[model samples]
Target: GWTYGLNGELRKATRISGIEDFSINVFRRDFGLVPIKVATWGPFVLLNMDNEILQKDNIDTDNVASEWLGSSSELFSLNGVDTTLTYVCRREYIIECNWKVFCDNYLDGGYHVPFAHKGLASGLSLDSYTTSIFEKVSIQSAEGGSKEKEDDRLGSKAFYAFIYPNFMINRYGPWMDTNLAIPLGPRKCLVVFDYFLEASFKDDKAFIERSLADSEKVQMEDIRLCEGVQKGIESPAYSTGRYAPNVEKAMHHFHCLLYDNLIN
Candidate 1:
């Protein structure tokens, strides 16, 4: 076993006699260790293979979450996310579009929610939806449209936070889910969904089932919109488009970050 420093240098190395000897002998030559930087935020683990990038950017992984979240950091704790939640299940969706397209759809505030997610919109107050962009994160929040009910799936408030470049965290009601977009090719991506719920609700089978179903419906709707946007972008008729100044600020921020990364 070995421990490494943030700079990707070996800090300590140890071996268990017999077991380690057998494993070492299995390889014709002694094992060469590759250094990697790892950090953990709650249950999520982050890994970086190239420590030079961190040194070049002067980044501290210890504060990455708070730096990205900025003023909205409190909301995560207030909602009991990452702390008092129990992971329930995971779902994966393959989308026929660039990963960026899916991210763009999410960072558009709630502009498409009313039109594309009618059922979901009915539960959320679109008029109260707002977007806030931080250094490397964007948050969209909304209040529930109606008074909370015993069976309300969306509770009284919701927060959808995107951590650049390909991670999303959504907290609503007593539920939280994360989305990770991975690019497979120029026009294909895989979106992984991990669902979590407040520990108190873990035993409520009916509530869990209904909430997941509602979420699935909205995701299916977004998949269609994202796939269609990809088709439109590939068409000769579509070259460029304008951003909605108020609702699409987050999406624009995302593109700017991409541009800066590419050029730098």
Candidate 2:
């Protein structure tokens, strides 16, 4: 059996305005009260086919068991911007690399930023960048300014959050982009970037246009870097390598998750 229901009122409070690239799986089931277990936690609704199985595991469905998902409770807040905005752009790329490789590259955080990304490197102060490990996610952020445009706006902080198994949220100023890595094959992944900005900024054509242009530049740089890494992964001389605990904590955290899940 499967279950689904979010309170009509609570749903509005949790509104994202527009979810953009966020994905959810939906299914339908007929009404039946026989031999099924249902669980409800904060913002999480779960169902299982066997009630006895849940009991045997000492699982309580009615009471909260697991912590909430994602990094925050109010992930889509507008901050200083107007709240009536919606996502306006979605850009996608198909990179010739294993999905894990793509994720590994992302998890490396700013390790390669100063070396591989000239534009991004200029914007990000490498020393000021920081990475943190959470139970189910990791974050890498920095205070930055591009050499071309040095933090012209008050909202110049660059924030990047990664949810396990290839979901990424990045915010630079009033613009936010979510990246989803979808595996296509053993060594291919489809990555999508869905961009959102403050509704008030929509009227400022120059800002929006420049933002998109700069975003494309950053994406292209990442694509090239990832592709090069994919080629390196194919080299027979290389197998696996170590990580810098101080710098690549997020990458290390992701690998731990992968190992733990595989062990199960």
lDDT of 2 by residue, 33-96 (tens): 2344556543224466665564564555423233333444243233222234467789889998
The C-alpha TM-scores of every prediction are 0.82, 0.71
Global lDDT for candidate 1? 0.83
Tens digits of per-residue lDDT for model 1, 1-264: 666555545555576446645454343234435545566666577676676753454457768567546666776676656766799999999999999999999999888998999888888888999888888878889888776432277888888889889999998888889999999999999999999988889999998998999899999999999999999999999989899998998999899999999999
Q: How close is candidate 1 to the true structure, as a TM-score?
A: 0.82
Question: Which pairs of residues collide in model 1?
Answer: none
Task: State each model's C-alpha RMSD to the native.
Answer: 6.0, 11.1
State which candidate has the highest lDDT.
1
Top TM-score: which candidate number?
1
Q: What lDDT would each prediction earn against the true structure?
A: 0.83, 0.68
Alpha-carbon deviation at 39 in model 1, angstroms: 2.7
